[model samples]
Target: MASSPNIFGKAQADVLAETGTALLQIKNSRRLTLEDMARVLGRTDDMVAKYIAGEAEMGFVAFRRASEAWPELTEKLNGGAE
Candidate 1:
């Protein structure tokens, strides 16, 4: 069987990469290593690295879980929502 078309364009991929970079910065600012983040998200260190490198898309649940692990980023992530 043939593969499906690419729904996400280069621009979108770029944006995701940028977001991943930003998230990586946030994690760093918190003094958390990739292994620490992996433990928090119940993922492997490689998976965390991939997510931060924008090689993989982080689902909403993982994002939310990450925010929970670092409560400070939650407000900023959700636009100050409660």
Candidate 2:
């Protein structure tokens, strides 16, 4: 049997893309590598990359850590982060 379709579909993809962009911007602003972001979130570098690539969902704890890591970017992103 096939897996059920994602309920949100396109909307979900849009959110992921926006999230990836925001994270990328924040990382660039901090001059941080994927490893740095992983360290900040207590995750692995590949996990950070997956989140950035829109292949993983960002957990609240990770979001909080990122916000703490770069408050300015987080605020900017909240204001239509694209």
Candidate 3:
């Protein structure tokens, strides 16, 4: 049987957790609901919620757009090094 992919490992997991926390914080600070974020990203609320919950992986394009649009997000959440 083929082994399943390890979704969460060391580095990636840490980044995902940090990103999720940051997204949540930003959402709370802006009084934006998951639906709001979904609208902004042109995605479904369920997808945004999944990303915030760390249940879904964010693609590089989406991540880059978000980081560019909300620099504070990466700074506050990802340690501001990127």
Residue by residue across 1-82, what tens digits does model 1's lDDT show?
9543343444656645765776677777888888888888888889889887878877788878887777755454344532
lDDT of each: 0.72, 0.78, 0.75
The CA root-mean-square deviation of candidate 2, after full C-alpha superposition on the true structure, stands at 3.5
lDDT of 2 at 61: 91
Superposed on all Cα atoms, the candidates' RMSDs to the truth, in angstroms, are: 5.2, 3.5, 3.9
TM-score attained by model 1: 0.66
Alpha-carbon TM-score of each model against the true structure: 0.66, 0.76, 0.74
- Candidate 2 per-residue lDDT over residues 6-75, each given as its tens digit: 5245456666666787888888877899998899998999998988897888889988988887776466
In the range 32-69, model 3's lDDT, one tens digit per residue, is 88887877776789988888888788887777766775
lDDT of 2 at 65: 88
Q: Say which candidate scores most in lDDT.
A: 2
Runs off by more than 4 Å, candidate 1: 1-10, 71-82
Clashes of 1: 0
Query: Which of 1 and 2 is the better model by lDDT?
Result: 2
Best-to-worst order by TM-score is 2, 3, 1
Best TM-score among the predictions, by candidate number: 2
